[model samples]
Target: MGNEKETPEERRERMRQRELSNPSSSGHGSNLSDLVGGLGWKGTGLLILLIITGFVVYSLATGN
Candidate 1:
């Protein structure tokens, strides 16, 4: 069975079933560190960029 090839839909359904059977394994209840770690370097960089942009916009709006 391990050697058998699964179609994309089949694989997706299998994964869905696995997640349903093990809710904790889906990472929905993970901590902040785990969530950030899962985002990888590029995602972390983009998040930092967004935060800096928001700060700049707020500062400009407040004229401070």
Candidate 2:
């Protein structure tokens, strides 16, 4: 009986308050960690592509 339904706005506000109360729990860390942690398949593919491109460029520069 004590538990009442919360409206959408109320629920959103409650969640916002909870997030504000615990800043660390928000999952935002250092910029580098955030960038690395947020990487997905696309980022991984791009990293691979960059590595291959770098190898090719290095070999070309070395005439190898």
Candidate 3:
């Protein structure tokens, strides 16, 4: 029977099982905050770049 139809409960159960199987890639966007701690190195680089850019702009504007 290739044209099988699943009931509502069956569909829900299937979705739950799929989520439990792959918890990391479950199409959830709520874990993006977890990336903040993981970006330690990148965050430091970004801060350095911002500071350098600000200094350059200030020096150029003030002729220092």
lDDT of 2 by residue, 1-64 (tens): 4227887888889889997798788677556555656897689678779989999999999999
Worst 10 residues of 1 by lDDT: 26-35
TM-scores for the candidates: 0.50, 0.42, 0.39
Best by lDDT: 1
Our model 1 lands, by Cα RMSD against the true structure, at 9.3
Ranking by TM-score: 1, 2, 3
lDDT (Cα atoms) of all candidates against the true structure: 0.87, 0.80, 0.77
* Pairs that clash in candidate 1: none
Candidate 3, residues 1-64, lDDT tens digits: the string is 4226878888889878988788767667556455656669788678679889999999999999
Residue 9 in candidate 2, Cα distance off native in Å: 39
How well is each residue in 2-63 modelled by candidate 1, as lDDT tens digits?
52688888988999999879989965787777767999999988988999999999999999
Considering summed lDDT, which 10 consecutive residues are worst modelled in model 3?
29-38
How well does candidate 3 score on lDDT at residue 2? 25
